[model samples]
Target: ASATERVHLGPTVTNPLTRHPAVAASGIASINRLSGGRAYFGIGSGDSAILNLGLRPAKLADLHEYMQAMRTLLAGESVDYKGRSIHVKWSNNQIPLVMSAEGPRTLAMAGGIADAVIVHSGLTKDVLADTIARIREGERAAGRPEGSAKVWAFAKCNISDNHDDAIDEIKMALAASGHHAFRHTLEGKNVPEELQEAVRVLQGEYVTSQHEQLGETRNKALSDELGLTDFLAERFAVAGTPDECLAKVRDIRDAGVDNLLILAISSQTDDLIRRFGEQVIARI
Candidate 1:
């Protein structure tokens, strides 16, 4: 209660926490003012996070409604709820709306109402291009200005001759397939025949967080548990010397990534981040 009284969070982070839209509006406004316009709200459809809390994730319909209400209130407009338009009391009408999106529908919806979309990594070149196309489509549908919404991809970086350590770092980073990079890096687009069989038996009962594997992680434990070979995991991560690491990221840039968040893979992250930033990022 003491903590709740001192801080006003901008709605629950996911759909299941559909706490009242009016309450969300008031809280976001309060925080936005306090932060002097530095506040940006990010939200996503609840998945594992919701399940962890024993709550069911949100439906698309509900997410869309929530976004619209959030936008209206942040714009300083009192919005009516349901068919009857409800108004929020003491509305500040001055906060930014950003939605966390890694999937198609959510990306489109973010364009429709939110100011930005947080794209999860495992964002392959082809995938990012497609996702961007869909987000633009939503902007067109909503009659919003082009480039009104921004998209950010989750990213990780580690550069060293001993990048094997880096790969090892990313392996443990993901547990239960709860991330973006791990999904594509390990599982890949073409499902393997063996995994396909596993897929058959598993069907909806899928195990492992394929998305949690960083593009540069090597978890021997996870690999062995999943019956994966080093060769299997190799395709997902970028290791070897600094020169090799630089080239890997150039490909990512070529694919058209905009924002890349470098998760700390080393105790010397800032120096390494700067090293990569100055050398690799500067060139590309």
Candidate 2:
């Protein structure tokens, strides 16, 4: 132990460091005891972090297997595998399984297995509400009570006095975030072909007609190709003053989202974050 005492699962190919089932459980137990049951475990299927690692994406089934294995190990139960009781483990703390869900399969799995489910950024109210529905479906299948899946959302938000500047920043984030940061779940929600194409080309599979960097010259084409102009402004994120942004949050809440993890963007995040903390979030 470093006295600071930190151990993580081995590095994951897709996301951040991934813990093998046995190793992850042990570390979780260790942290739990050290923190007096205050430790938390979060599982994600490699996002851009995974992509940058030159690895394939993670699957929902894989997450479920990991969660089950962790639960079994931490509960002091030895699972029988390959003619042996494998990885005997135990802990006094209730190790919670939280899933970072995006697509339908992952959403359903989180609803069924995860103690809590977190929705990632580039969010739209319609998409958020639909994802939650899928999660609830998984809960029902598992015979769990209603609202068993605790749903939360994470977003890249930019708030500013100059709405145009804020819009530009949001556009840049959306242009790139589509590929790996967000999943394509808003395809047939009666959205435009161009916006759909933008999301699809980024996340789906479509080559650009021209050569350009994603954030530089190329993003404009990509945004235009995908028709992200209006939709990006409307559906993806909230960027504006406090009063303006709160309406967006209200819309997301009305769509059944439970909690929001806002990534406030600016030259310095403090200004935007403080404003949200003192004004937007404080009031709402």
Candidate 3:
């Protein structure tokens, strides 16, 4: 079997606020052409990209308008954007448009417009069900057919023979969820009160430069102070032996998620990818 069929390549997310819609459209279109249409465009309000620039994420209304403008430009039609007309001369709008959504409003908007929706929340039955229901509500409101928008679960996976050690690996990455902007997304999930309190404290003390990083000095201190090493290890990540991870993957698949993305929680990203492919993915 060819490796191509299993690989779908594209940006995880790009925002309308930082990059202009025409530029974004051109980038996605070029990737699609280069990859022979295996590219998908996943857009969202900026997270680290915008936050690092001392800016806020794009508004939901802006994201919707931006998506429309991108589609128009990619379809060879001139778009009236930012008081100027713009167009992409050589591109086809064949790439799938996905959205990396977290909140209910953004999730609904993605349901109505995007070909797929990616959620960063951990894989739990109740959370997955709730997220899917919100998206379905948006679809019904927009009169889109059932299953028109696919739901993808993005899980930070850290697998090892020692289950506890594997669980420990994702503690740093889980810190991102504790940030004020993203903290609410985990509110209604099956998180413990103590852990929630820890996250609240973390929101006050998080360093922007160390956002979503692993094994850093700041992260280690934070993890130690809040005692989040074991608390979030189980709830926010797919961490365990290969067998255990496979079981979690099965649960996610059975929960009606269209895709499961394993965000490798390791310094050696390439090694993790290879190991995951050989062990967990092959079994799944």
Candidate 4:
């Protein structure tokens, strides 16, 4: 129904360590103009992209500064960066900025700045509620109204009659989600005390090079060996029969997720998308 809904580069890293915030803003503004204002920028603290390069995720303060710089540049204004002035003179798109967050601090920061947030926390009712609460906390801190920032749930998905196969297919993605969400810290993440050690082991053993790979990588193997596949699936995925996936989606909607960012990581990605559109999305 809206032009802005047509395209998004959801959850790309626009951190200073990865890409200069000024350049990223100019790029998005260019794309927005070219696409008739259909483009919005989505960013996050670096994950596999930075880790694979042997770098840490951007510090929260740096991320916050980058978001501020982006806001100014995209609005056709000049901003100072490291004793230099930067501006995107050709464009003034002011496209929406969406941030991806998995942890409490990141969620709060995103709520303060991002126009929307793609939450990588699990879809369980309690977890989703807590994540939203953290975002609201940030909003309140920034003097923004309640529910000012929209929320989108990031979910790994597949549709199949064989439930076991479906689960197996997305284990690697679920593993990636766990690594992304828990690698920084386990505190306040609602991680059970009993499984904390296992989670730490998974975080250490996870292979950044094979992130989200479809095959039986070491990441998937570690998830299985650590007895984490089912737990990760329950938290981060929505894979099963069409009816089952639809029910899960409805629950997510009820939990106040304003949008769904489905990550179809299976080899049959096209088929899964088509089936989800027809069977799950259509019904919902």
C-alpha TM-scores of all predictions: 0.67, 0.77, 0.90, 0.95
Residue 44 local lDDT, model 1: 69
Model 2 residue 12 distance off true place after TM-score fit, in angstroms: 14
Q: Mind giving the per-residue lDDT tens digits that candidate 2 earns over 1-284? A: 22544543212122324556666767777867775565656777865555555566666666676677667877877765325566745554467767777667677878888777777533576677777788899899888987887776766577777767666655555555455444546532434554564666666542223222223455545555666655665655677777778888887777777777665555667877888777677777
Q: Which digits, one per residue and each the tens of the lDDT, describe model 4 over residues 1-284?
A: 13455656423445568788777887787677667777778888888888999999988888888888888888889999767899887777768888888889999999999889989888999999999999999999999998888999989999899888888888888889899999878988988888889999988899999999988788888888888888898899999889889999999999999999898878978999999999999999
Badly placed stretches (over 4 Å) of model 3 are: 1-6, 180-195, 227-231
> How displaced is residue 159 in candidate 3, in Å?
1.6
Badly placed stretches (over 4 Å) of model 1 are: 1-20, 82-94, 157-161, 174-220, 227-249, 265-284
**lDDT scores for all predictions?**
0.57, 0.64, 0.76, 0.86
lDDT of 4 at 170: 82
Ranking by lDDT: 4, 3, 2, 1
Clash number for each model: 12, 7, 0, 0
Across 1-284, the per-residue lDDT of candidate 1 in tens digits comes to: 22344433343244526456766666667776665555566676665555556565576687887878877876767776676676665666556676766556667887777777766524456666776777888899999997888766554455665756655555543323223222322233334566544323322333233334445333324543455423332433444457776776676667665555445455676877777777666876
Clashes of 3: 0
